[model samples]
Structures are given as structure tokens and as C-alpha cells.
Target: MGGNHAATGAAAWIAVTASTPIAFGWYPVSDASVFTGALVCAGAALLPDADHHSGTIANSLRPVSNVVVKGIEAVSGGHRKGTHSILGIAVFTAIAWALSLLSIDTGDALFGAILIGPGIMCVLLVAFALKALKITRDTKLLPWTMSVTLAVLIAIFAPEEWYWMPFSVALGCTVHIVGDLITTNGVPLLWPLKFRSPYWMRNKRGLELDWMWRAGGNLSLPILGDAGSVREWIFLIPVSLYAVTGIVWALLDQMGYDTMAIWYQIVAALPF
Candidate 1:
């Protein structure tokens, strides 16, 4: 149904992570938590797309996200300028986090520690970011809400493995943040602190064309600039290989886990 690239990537990442517990002996094939964890983690990774009114989950909650996005946009300006600010992150996370508390057995972790105990510190951090960016609202709250909801659902059901579920979900959100950051500039992940996380994607080669097309081939994204110098090419080539390597690794890991799941299923079904 026209999946988002970043969402698909997040799901694959969830699979990669969920499989690790099995690989490490923290859980078994029969564990409901493991299965639930895999499913929920995938959804959480894809949660940020709620910003798109046309998005699957977002479309379902048009009225709410529309209002939220509108309010945020009025307050913050537009994409990357406000909703990507710190206030946005906290407000987005708070609702999900509170809901999570009701459903899951939250533990202590970095995200949790920051979320709990005088946690106004973290919220203020996010708030300060929003204030600094002059960001007050967004046109895209649906995707963020949906993504965070999925994370909370996962947290409620996922079993404790390598780390806490909230932390894992928080980390998952970071992937979404970082994914977008690669495409745009002046992205302040944490606002109000005088720190700017500006990682841009404007190279003329490879996926630059595909990405550029999404922005309407606008002036901001170029077609073929210089392909950069040999040194830059060296950096670009290996970094580009990340896509290939990540795919292969995920595929092999999936096959291995599936094989294990099947074997265990057969054993459970054995007449002996």
C-alpha cells in the first residue's frame, strides 16, 4: 500500500533488534514477549510518518493530527523549523510515555531516567529547543503520534531483554530523526541549547537523484554537481555501501531467525 522508505527501514531495524534477544538466549521461540516485541518495535520505528495526512495511520486520525499539526505550525512555522524542535519531541513523547506507564512495566534506563525523576529537566530541554527554534506547532503531528503510539504499544507487551522497552523505542525514534536529518540541513534534534545537528544530503550522485525528486527537483536538491573530489568520493562510496551492507546483513539474519522459528515449531508439533 505504498510503504514509506524510512518506515520500511525501521521495520527491518526492528527485526534486526528483536532477533538479537533470541540470538543471545534472553528469550525463547515460545515467548509471547519476543513475538510481540518484534511486531511492536517495527511499528514504533515507522511511527514518525503520522505527520503525513495521506499516511496510513495518520489518515485514520485526520482531525486530530490536522489540528495538532496546525497548532504546531502556527507556533513553530513549518517543518524542521519547529516541530523538529525540542518542545515538539517532548510533547510528542510525553503523551506516549504516560500511556506507556499505564500499560507496561517501565524500568530504569537512560531515556527513562531522563523521563522520570525531576524529569522536567528533559521536558525543559525539549521545550527550550522549541522556544529557541521559534517553533510552536507543526502540520505533521499524526505521523509522530502514531509512531510513538506504536512504541508505547510495544512497550506494554514487549518483554525485557537486552534493555528497557521505552529506551529501545526512544532509540527507534532517534533512527527516524536521524534518517530525516540526512536529507535536510539545520535540523536541531535538541533545541534551545545552541547546538545544531546539521547533516545534509545534497550530493549529486546515487540516491541524491531519487531524494531530489521528492522535493520536486527544487533548487535545494541538485542533480549532478561535481560528484565531489576523490576524497569525498571515497567517503561517499563507503557510506553508500551502508545501504547494501545493511540489506545483506538484515536478510541473512532474517533467514536465520525464520529457520530457527520453523525448527522450533516443528519440534513443538512432533508426535514424539
Candidate 2:
């Protein structure tokens, strides 16, 4: 899938999952959390690829990303290896958990702020262990780790909201992973232990934008599949429909026909 497709998939999944807990009456969530959490997760899903020099995300961070990639390549024996390794997962998880502490609404004592971050880090480590053991590979479940980590966060800070919040967050992120798996090369939903997954998607013929260079300034403006053929139009319609439906749904929901807003989803999911 293309970057736009992948990102949209992430957004749709987040919207669906975020609504799950709210609809089920788990906890009262401010819109900010929902938006923040979704974007955070979607960002994470897109992020792993940043370990690669030529990836869309890698360039944005530039020299720092370059340094990280070089370091990982030195250690993992190549660009994607070390960063994709279990060791790297641990490192990144710790970093993210430590960073998450900054989001807490209440202040902590000096020691509390410092030690608390690592404590949160420990919880994230445990979640990663759990996913590594139980979820199986190639499923969107890897992203579920984001939800589980958030669950631990909820448990500590908003105990009452713990029940369904993680479920919603995981669902959204997993859906993004699932969307990607539909393409030719799938993810190892179950990693370390179980191996790969069964999901397969039809890969794109050509995405207009190409990440030929890793230097932040080189990504090409994506050209839609050719504008000249019937086949191109074939890809265009569904793509157009997908984009428009999302827009329409947002409009209707804003217009107060929220219940009717899911019409696009039904159409998208329909087996034509």
C-alpha cells in the first residue's frame, strides 16, 4: 500500500476503535485524548519504517535519523535489521514510555517524575512481553501493544477508565496493521515466537511518490496512478470513493446525523 493509503487506513481504524469504548460506555474521554491517542498510535505504526533511510518518515528527522539508521545497520548487519530487532523494540518502548510521562495531567515530586517514568517504562516492557508471547504474528496485534501500554497508563492515572480504553486503542492501531497486511508483503503479526501471518493484500502497481533519497527534501509529489487508462480509472474510483466517504461521514456527523454517518463504511466493506 501507498503512504496515503496506509495513513488513511490508520485514521479509519483509530476512529472506529476510539468510538468502541465510548459507545460501550467504558469511560468519559475528552476529544483530545481520542485524537491524541489515535494520532500517537498511527504515528507509531508509520514510525518503525523510519529506521530505514529511504522511508518517508526517516527523512523528516534527517541527520538524527541518519545516525540512528547507520548505528542500527552497523549492529543489525543492515538498515532494517537492528532497528527491527527485539533489542531495538525494547529500547524504543522504554523511550516511548519515558516520554509518555510528560503527558500526565498532575505534577509529581522530583523523584516521582524521574522514577515514575522508568516505572511506566517497566509496565511497557511487560506489555511487550505479553504480546510477544500470546498474540501470534502478522496480525494487527503488534499495534495492540500501543493499546496495552496505554492501558497500563490508564491503570495508573485513570483507574476507572482502564477497562475499555485499551481495547479501543488496540483495535484502532491493529486495524492499521491489518490494512497494511492486505498487501503483497505482510507483517509478522506474531513476532519472535510464532513467525509470520496469513493476511495478504493486493499491492499497488506504482505509488506516485517515491522515497529514492533519504535526505528529507527528496520525496516526490505523488502522481495518482496514470490518468490515461480504464484500469487507472478503475483504481481511481474506489480511491476517490474512499476519500470522499470519509469526508462525507465527518460532514454528516458534524451536521448531527452521526448515526447515519457510518453509511460509507458499509459501502466500503461491501463485497461488490
Candidate 3:
């Protein structure tokens, strides 16, 4: 797992790239727009891990995620299988595109029902049957229950473009796959064929290009090991810097500042 931090970093990088003048030459972006895009990208980064029952995505979605995780595991023979493959990317992207085409009203209604119905029922059932079901002591369900309810409420009531939601999710999933490529157990980039990154990136000397191919595989940092570890830092730090710089430049450009001249001024002001 790239963990939340790495996943977020990847998403942030994507968001920053998308916010660039070059990337959005045909489109306009405001602060709100950039923020929304960033949020979507970050959320999408976690989509690939939907198959992992204990993962953040699964946990957030709870009961529904339970079913989804199990189903994916059963069909794919476990994690890092179908969902991590190129075919999986295509499938997810298609789903996102399709979802983007959904009528706002229809989508809101359906999502509202899914979120509210289960939550209300769960609340009523728990309240009435707490003692009867011997569930009085366990309060763990509350968090997920509340989360579902709140998420749904936000999804339905919040003002948003709506169409980009699915695309953001798809983008996140794609980022997850790319993030996994750094792991020791590289993703099945081409599933069914089961071609892992190591095999393809191996040199003629019969050695895996560990540095370039399995970068995350070598992480040994403490606490955030394997996720925001040293290896991740190597890629994340530079990308983050670039993203921040881009955001600043964009904002300055929008404000009518000569961003390049500003950069030169900052450099000139340095003690060195």
C-alpha cells in the first residue's frame, strides 16, 4: 500500500498538473475550482484499494464496501489483481465516464436513498434491538453509520459540478495503480497475462531495475514505512514542490503579476 500520504501526494501532483496553464489552456480555473479538482484527485487516489477490506476506502464506505471488497477479492483471487491491472483502469475509467453522464437530479436521488435509507434503518434497528441483539456494548457501528449518512448528505445537498465526481474517482484509481508499481509485489499492469513491472523493467543483465522499477519496494523509513517512506519522499518531495510552485505561479499570473520576474526577484534577494 502507498498509504494515505503517498496516495494523497500522488493526487496532489495530478491536481497541480491539471491546474497548470498549459494543461488548462482551454479551460479556466478559480481557487474554488482548483480546490475541487484537488479534492477529487485525492479521493481518486484511494480508489484502487477498494478491494482491500481493511483499506481506507473500504472502511469509509463500510457495509457497502464490505460487499465490494469481498466480491473483488473472490473474482480477482485477492488484492493487486484485476483492480490493479490496465484492464481494470479501462473498466474504471469507463465507469467514471458513464457516471459523469448521469443526470444530476437522478444521481442525487439515488445516492441520497442509498446513504439515507441504510443509515436510518441502521439507527432504528440499533435503537430498538440494542439489548435484544446484544449490541449494546459495541458502538463501533456509529462511526461508519454516521459517515455514510454525512457523506451521502454532502453528495446530495452540496453544490458541485457533479459530472466530474466519477472522473476524479477514476483518476484516483489510476494513481493508485501507478503508486503500486513501486511496491515489491508490482501490480499486474497487464492482468490475465500477469505481467509485473519487474519483469518488463529488468535489464539484459537479468537484474530488476530496482531503483527505477521497484522504487517503493526499497523503502525502510520508520512509522510511515512502505507508504510515506524514504523512497516515496524521493518522488513526493520534488513533485510536491513542483505542484506548489505551479499553484503559486498560476495564482500570481491570475493576479496580473509577472511570475517569472517575481521568481527572479526572490532568487536575487537570497543571501547567496
Candidate 4:
């Protein structure tokens, strides 16, 4: 899946999850916490594509991304290898869970450092030094790094409820894998037990399945197609409607509105 589509899918998931009873067990207590969890999920959604050197995440992270991508590619042998597989999601989930187990107090201290004078200055100085040295050809890298750095700092300092952090990250990763399943070259979902997209969805010359993939693939354009495309709408409309309904229902419930009663009233007013 394109980076933008992955992001949109993740956002839609977050919105729907936030507004539904399904996520009640994992829900955070505060709005700020909810937003933090959503952001983490969104970032994690882009992590699998870290192996694609030209990918948005990689372009955003620069020299660090170059190193990270190269390392992963070396071990995995190419794009859509380990990171796009079931094994990757499990490993990442485990890592997130382990990180969650760390003393919250320690995270708080590091968070403080990231926000304070010396910590902020240290980051700025390093960025400046890197820019002056021309160590990276991508000028956007500095700003992207700074933005990501600040986001991480906020996540650490402000801190959502512990348990949901890992869950949100893992959910994001899972969403990414699912999104890639619809692409021209479907993801290696099962990895060692490789299989292509089901027969119904397979590409075959002159067949409907082939045409579907071609259209969907074109609509899956990462950033641009996300703006507004019929193909995108085909996927987005139903999901967006579902998510909006959930969000509205959740909001009304929180506000003490009798949503069911309002729905009944609207239905009664409708002409037969």
C-alpha cells in the first residue's frame, strides 16, 4: 500500500476504534491520551515500509533511515520480506510490550530531558551540525527528524495509559499488512508459508479480477490518489461512513444525548 493510503487506513481505524464499544477494553481515560495513542498507531502504520528507501518514512528520516533500511534489507533480502510478514508484526508487538513494561518513572525522566533546555538544545545543535556538514542530501530530513523527535518526546512525557500503547502500535502494523494485501504484488502475509491473493482476486489477462487489481492499484497511489478518486472512494466511503457513525454515536452518548430517541424522531419525520 502507498504510504498515504496506509496512513488513511490507520486513521480510519483509530476513529472507528475510538468511537466503538469494541475498543472499550483498550480505551484510554482522557482525550489527550486518546490522541497520543492515535498518533503512535499512525506512525507504526508507516514502519513496515521502512525497507523501501524511497518511501515516505525513509525520506523523512534520512541518514538514520538509510542505515535502518539498508540493515533490514540486508537481513530480509528485499522489500516485502520480514517486515511485511506475520512474523514481523509479532516481533514488533513483543518489543512494544517489553517497552511498556519499563518503569514509567524512567520514561518520565527521559521525557523531561527531551522537553527541557539542554535536551532541546542538544537536538538543535546536532541538527545544525548535520546540516552544516552536508552529511545528508535530503534537505527535508532535518525538519522531518525534528518533527518525529518532538512527537516521540511528547508521547514519552505526556504518556498515555501504558497497556494501550503497545496494542495501538501492533494494530497499526496489522493494518499496514492488510492494506498491502490489496496491492498488485500482494504482501507475504504468511511469510514462510507463502500464498498469493485468493483466486477470486488474482490477476488474469482479460478477466474481471485483473481489471479490478489494475484499477485498485492505480487508485492506491500513496499521496495523490488519497485526495479524491473513485477507486479510493470505493474503499473509503463505507469505512468512513462506519467510522463517522461510530464517532457520532460515541460523542452523543458522552454528551448525554438520547441518540436512539433522536434517531427514532428522525425516522418518524421521514415521509413514506
Report the alpha-carbon TM-score of model 4 versus the true structure.
0.59
Error of 4 at 156 (Å): 6.0
| Poorly placed runs, candidate 2 (over 4 Å) | 9-13, 20-28, 72-94, 102-176, 189-272
lDDT head-to-head 1 vs 3, winner: 3
* Clash number for each model: 18, 10, 2, 0
TM-score winner:
4
- Consecutive 10-residue window with the lowest summed lDDT within model 4: 215-224
TM-score of 1: 0.41
Expressed as tens digits, the lDDT of each residue in 58-170 for candidate 2 is 33333444575555446544433334334445555556644444434345542122234433433333332222223322334443455446545644554432223333333
* Model 4 RMSD vs true structure: 8.9
Clashes of 2: 10
Q: How big is the positional error of residue 11 in model 1, measured in Å on the Cα after superposition? A: 3.6
Superposing all C-alpha atoms, what RMSD in Å does each candidate have to the true structure? 13.2, 13.8, 9.8, 8.9
| Native-to-model Cα distance after best TM-score fit, residue 153 in candidate 1, in Å | 11
Models ranked on lDDT: 4, 3, 2, 1
Tens digit of lDDT per residue, candidate 1, span 208-255? Answer: 433333332221122222223344344344433443343443455545
lDDT by residue (tens digit), candidate 3, 1-272: 43443335333534434445324433334543344344345545655665676655544434665686677767765677777777777776676666444433454554432333322322322222221222332344764454445444544554343444445555566666766665445566666663233545555466656544443332211322354467766766665555455556656665777866766878899999
Error of 2 at 167 (Å): 9.0
Among all windows of 10 consecutive residues in model 1, the one with the lowest summed lDDT is: 117-126
For model 4, residues 5-56, the per-residue Cα lDDT tens digits are 4444335444645634434534434443344444445556666665676655
Q: Which residue pairs show backbone clashes in model 3?
A: 44-172, 45-172
